[model samples]
Target: MTYCVGLLLDVGLVLLSDTRTNAGLDNIATYRKMYTFEEPGERVIAIMTAGSLSVTQTTLSRLQDAIDIPDGPSIMTVDTMLEVAEMVGAMLSDVSGKIAGRMGEQASAARASMILAGQRRGGEPRLFLIYPEGNFIEATSDTPFLQIGEHKYGKPILDRVVTPETTLEDAKKAVLLSMDSTLRSNLSVGMPLDLCVIPSGEQRISERVRIDAEDETFQAMSVAWSNALRRGFQEIEI
Candidate 1:
């Protein structure tokens, strides 16, 4: 399993995903879960996935193949972020159908889910949670975030700190702490995280990072957050 989270704030969007993928206890490995597509001033899109590697890899490959075909309705051709999401949902559902037919019902239900986020020229930024069925729902003012994979351990902080009014910088910190929470509680989701940030209206990814185990800044932030949590707990009267 893995953990991937996305924050949709008033100013921009922040996304983070772990690199770990595990087939069995001794078969653990790392692979990036974040994928980005950009045409600079024209559009920018990012996808973060969690679940069966076969399903996600195949789904992404099919989407890429469509994009490469002449006059294809790739994400780049969509007029709005909503349209982009619909195109992705349709492709994901199509690919998932093919894979499910081969694997049978129960196994296919374990496939995967994707978090899609980004913006296009003249359009507002959007965030979506693409379910295994290839249908999706957008993040709204009431719930400005979406998460997949080992999410139970990390959801508390997001519930407390994230909102439509949160700043992009704070959004980044929130996601990091959320990931930290998951890292502390789950063994399957391991290090070297991928993070992406897209500022509203930019039509480009403004920030992207790969945080390895030895990354000093992330280490320090994690340590500080732990300390803060401890202090907060200590202050609570039992």
Candidate 2:
């Protein structure tokens, strides 16, 4: 299992993902769940995945292969963000179907999903949650965020605090707190984490970072959040 989240704020896009993959309590490893494709001033794309590693990895590999082909219909070449979502959805579904077919009765274990966020030159940024069936739903003003994999543990803070108008700085805190919540409650979603920020109108990724388990800033933030939560809980009259 894993946890990945993306936010589409007026400023741009903010994405976060954990790097843990576990087959059992005794078998665990780390693998990055965030992938990016950028063409500097022309376009920028970020993909975050959660589910069966085989399915997600294969789908990403195929997407990269498509991009490598000269003048091919890849995420970078797609005319619109919608087309990119469609392309990713199709590739993910195709890869998942093939893998699941071979797995037979265990097909459900082979399912995976992705969150696609990007922008092209002269176009507005977009966010999508692509499911296992080649279909997706885009983020809208009413709900300016999308999350996958162990999402329930971290969704409350987003629901209460995030908005399309959120600043890039605050958005980063919101997502990190969201991940911190998930990490505390779920062992399957361990870190170090990957974080990316694409500023509005830049047509490029402005900030990309990795937050390791021992990062001091993240640790301090986590501690502060815990203390605040306890104080809030104590102040409430039940």
Candidate 3:
């Protein structure tokens, strides 16, 4: 299990994903669930995955293979952000279906999900949450964010504060605090996070940050959020 989120803003997009996968209590492992494809100055695509590692890995591997092939309809080669979302959804659905077919009774638990976000030159930025069945929903002004995996704990803050008009700086804080909330509540979502910011129409990543467990700035922010929440709870009458 893992936690991954993406935010769509007037400025661009912000994406974050934790790197933790576990088969059992004794079999935890770390693997990056975020992948990016770009032709700098032309287009950039980012993806965050959750659920069955096999399904997600195979889907991503196939996408990369397509990107490497000349004239293939990969994310980088897609005509629009909508096309990128469709291509990824189709690949994800196909991979999970085939793998689950071979797994027999465990098919139900072999499902996976992804958050696809990015932009192409001359196009507006876009974000999507794709299910194991290849279906996807886009982020809209009414819902400016998308999350996958262990998302419940982090959703409250976003619901209250995020808007299509949210400033990029505030959006960053909202997402990190959202992730912090999840990390505190879910052991399945562990550390070493990957975060990326892509400003609208830049056609390139503006910032890519990695926050490890020991990162002082993030630690400070987490502690601050916890304290603030505690204070608010204590001040409110039940």
Candidate 4:
């Protein structure tokens, strides 16, 4: 399991994902769960995935193969972000079905889900949560965020703080603090984290940051958030 979150704000988009994947107690490992693609001045897309590694990896490989072909049904070739989400959802569903078929219907481990966030040259930026069956839900003004994997522990802050009016800088802090909360509570999710920002109308990624366990800034932020939480808890009336 892992944690991946994306925000579609009025200013731009923010994305974050953990790199941890584990099979069992002794099989812990780090694997990148975030992917980005861009044609500067044309468009940009970022994907954060959670669930079966095989399904996600194979689905991405197939998408990459399509991306290499001109005029293909790849994400880069899509005319709108909605089309891109449709293409991705179909690919994910196909790959998942194939894997689950091979492993028998009883194999629950073959499931996977992904969050897709991006913009096309002439369209509004969009965020989607693609489910295992080739369907997805888009982010709306009322709910400007989408999340996948181990989400419950970190959702509170987002529910309280995120909105269409959030600035890109504040959006970053919200996601980092959200991820920090998850990291402290869930053993399945870990870092280094992959974070990226795509400012509206830039048609490309403007900033990308990788935060590891040893990073001082992230450490300090985590400590600060922890202390704030403690103070808030103490302030509550009994």
Candidate 5:
């Protein structure tokens, strides 16, 4: 299990995902869950995945193969972000079904989901949460954020703070804090997070970062959030 979250704000899009993948207590390992494809001034797409590694990896490979074909209906060549979502959903569902079928009685282990966020030239930035069955819902003004994996532990902050008008800087802080909350509560999700930011209308990734476990800035921010939470909890009269 892992934790991945994306925020769709008026100014741009922010995405973050952990690097941990675990089969068991002794089988823990690190694998990047965020993948980005960009054509600089043309378009940018970022995918953050959670769930079965096999399903996600295979789906991405298939998508890449399609992209290699000139003028094909791949994510890059799609006319709109919606089309990109549809194409990804179809690929994910197909890969998931085939992998689960081969797993026989352990089909549940092959389940996977993804958060897709991007912008095409002349299009508004979009965010989507793609389900395991090839269907997805987009983030709207009412809900400007989407999350996957070990999401419950980190959802409260987003519910209280994220909105379509959020600034890009604040959005980044919000996502990192959300990830910090999950990291504390879940052992399956681990360090060295991948974070990406795409400013609206830029058609390119403005910021992409990898935060390690010992990163000073993240450490300080995490401590500050914990302290603030403790103070808030104590201030609430029982």
Candidate 6:
């Protein structure tokens, strides 16, 4: 399994995902779950995936193939973020159906999911959680976020602290804490996290980071969060 989360704030969007894919105790391996497409100042899109490696990889590969076609509706040619999302969902659905049909039930159960987020030159930044079936739902002001795979453990922090008005910096912290929660609870989701930030109206990724096991900033943040949680528990009435 994998864990991928994205936050849609007033400022922009923030996304994070883990690389671990666990088949069994001895079959663990690492694979990238984040993919990006950008035209610099015109548009920028990021996709963070989870679930079955086969389905996700095939779907992504096919999407790339379509983009390579001369007249296809690739991410670069889309006029708006919503259109880009619709195109992705349609492509994912088509690829997943073929893979599932070929693999039959058990193998197809490993179907993947993805979180798509970004902006086009003339539109607002948007975020969507794409399901294994290829349908998707956007993040709205009321929810302000979306997540997939091993998401249960990390949802609490987001529920308590995240909102549409949260600053992009704070939004990033919320997602990191959310991922930290999942890491502690799910053995299948392991280290070396990928993070991406897209500031509103920039039409480009503002920040992206890969946090390894010994990354100092992530280590410090994790420790501080642990201590803070302990203190919060201590201060609460029994």
Using lDDT, give the best candidate's number.
2
Candidate lDDT scores, in order, read: 0.89, 0.96, 0.92, 0.93, 0.95, 0.88
Which candidate has the top score in TM-score? Answer: 2
Clashes of each: 0, 0, 0, 0, 0, 0
* Candidate 1 ranges beyond 4 A from true positions: none
Give the alpha carbon lDDT tens digit for every residue of 1-238 in model 6: 8999999988999999999997767899999999998878998999998877887888888888878999877877978878888888887777777777887667567577889999888788999988878789999999998999888999999999999999988988999999998899989998999999999989888888899989899889999999999999999997
TM-score of each: 0.95, 0.98, 0.97, 0.97, 0.97, 0.96
> 134 in model 4: Cα distance from truth in Å?
0.8
lDDT of 6: 0.88
RMSD per model, one decimal: 1.4, 0.8, 1.2, 1.1, 1.1, 1.3
User: For model 1, how does the per-residue alpha-carbon lDDT over 130-226 read when each residue is reduced to its tens digit?
Assistant: 9888889999889999999999999999999999889888999999999998998999999999999999888899999999999999999999998
Q: Candidate 2 on 1-238: residue-level lDDT in tens?
A: 8999999999999999999998878899999999999999899999999999999999999999999999988999989999999999999999999999999899999999999999999999999999999899999999999999999999999999999999999999999999999999999999899999999888899999999999999999999999999999999997
Using lDDT, rank the candidates from best to worst: 2, 5, 4, 3, 1, 6
Better of 2 and 5 by TM-score: 2
Model 6 Cα displacement at 129 (Å)?
1.1
| Candidate 5 lDDT tens digits, 1-238 | 8999999999999999999998877899999999999999899999999899999999999999999999887999989999999999999999999999999999999989999999999999999999999899999999999999999999999999999999999999999999999999999989999999999999899999999999999999999999999999999997
RMSD of 1: 1.4
Candidate 2, number of clashes = 0
Whose lDDT is higher: candidate 4's or candidate 6's?
A: 4
- Winner on lDDT between 4 and 5 is 5
Candidate 2 lDDT at 12 equals: 96
Q: How many clashing residue pairs are found in candidate 6?
A: 0
What does the lDDT come to for candidate 1? 0.89
Model 4: CA > 4 A from native: none
